[model samples]
Target: MEENRLPFDAVILAGGRSSRLGGVPKQDLVFHHATLLQRALAASAGAAGTVVVGPRPEFSLPGVILCREEPEFAGPAAAISAGLEALARHCTSASEYTLVLACDMPLVQDAVAVLKEALVPAKGDGVMARSGDGTLQPLAGIYRTTGLKKAAEELASRGTLNNGSVRSLLASLEVQPVTVPAGSTADVDTWDDAAALGIAAGNQDKKPGPAQPQLTWEARS
Candidate 1:
């Protein structure tokens, strides 16, 4: 790793049922002429390795290790565990930290930059992003590799990761929450959210036009 770079790998959670979007895959939604998953990969491009946990998308994912949770459609916690395992098997060099991200956030690059910049001064097992409204966005966090792996192991030992909540998985860790810029952690959970982020489903082939208006932080909340 370079002197200015942090030694880390990335785990992107891309496997959600998208029940709110009526089964439309959030990762496939087009934003600025790129799929949400593609945007997420670009955001974490600095990582030593990246593993996308979910069903493989139709588009080619060059240089990405794709895998799915054991039961498929398992919760984020399970997906995270599977990502860790994939990293262990595929990554030649283990990193000290892990970037955990959800693929639905189009502006996640902003949040990733904030978390990485804050890591040097923050003292904890990880640094999680706190949105403008003070909601903790654990999915946008950077965690110590050992800490996260241990947490996953503990959860698996208790047979709880399959349907486990992210809150439960991080309960044992000491994490510093850093406030991020407005809209940095906003994600596409519903159609309204996609609209607010200037995202449209099934429009990857269309060229991006003028930049779309983004919703205010309050409006998004």
Candidate 2:
């Protein structure tokens, strides 16, 4: 792919029932010192703009477009649909591919390159990032708005949107699977999950997660 041939937009799914964290907004929850949304934004900043789908707007960032779901919300699927709809209205084409990343992932590294390499289909296509363990990480993946619209519309028409989750959506399309490094796919869901990331990142509960100096990821394009 050429340097500027970005084939998709990135949608960061922040709308979720963070019941595990006492119903706290996952995007607002801080990991070490950075908020989850901040980490997510940093991870997705270079992926053609970011759209945050969530209920609360209090944690809104500068560059991210915060959008909540309609119909009182169903789940991530609903939020994703809402984001896609809004993105479609603003963009030139609604058929453009979108990389839908969950906001809870603190270990997302080089998302632009990962999604770029994973987006392998001609015309319109979908892709998902898989960990070294081979589990299908549905949230950290891609979805064409056209494909999502089809499924969402169908489900909405039937008066039953229960079956149109991200997992089912990817199953319905020819999705490319990209392999991420071992520790780059942790989705900080529960309190335990965040704690584990802190421990792994060399930050215990008392101390904060110090930003490690590295030459792997450059600050600029």
For 116-164, candidate 1 gives per-residue lDDT tens digits of 8899887879899999899999999999989988999999999998999
lDDT of 2 by residue, 88-184 (tens): 6555654366778887887775544576665654344566788888987878876666787787676667765643577655545666777877767
Whole-model lDDT, model 2: 0.63
lDDT, each prediction: 0.83, 0.63
Positional deviation of 76 in candidate 2, in angstroms?
1.6
* lDDT (Cα, 0-100) at 111 in candidate 2: 47
Kindly report which residue stretches of model 2 are placed more than 4 angstroms away from their true locations once superposed: 1-3, 57-60, 92-95, 120-124, 162-164, 199-221
Reference-based TM-score, model 1: 0.89
* Candidate 1 Cα misplacement greater than 4 A, ranges: 1-5, 202-221
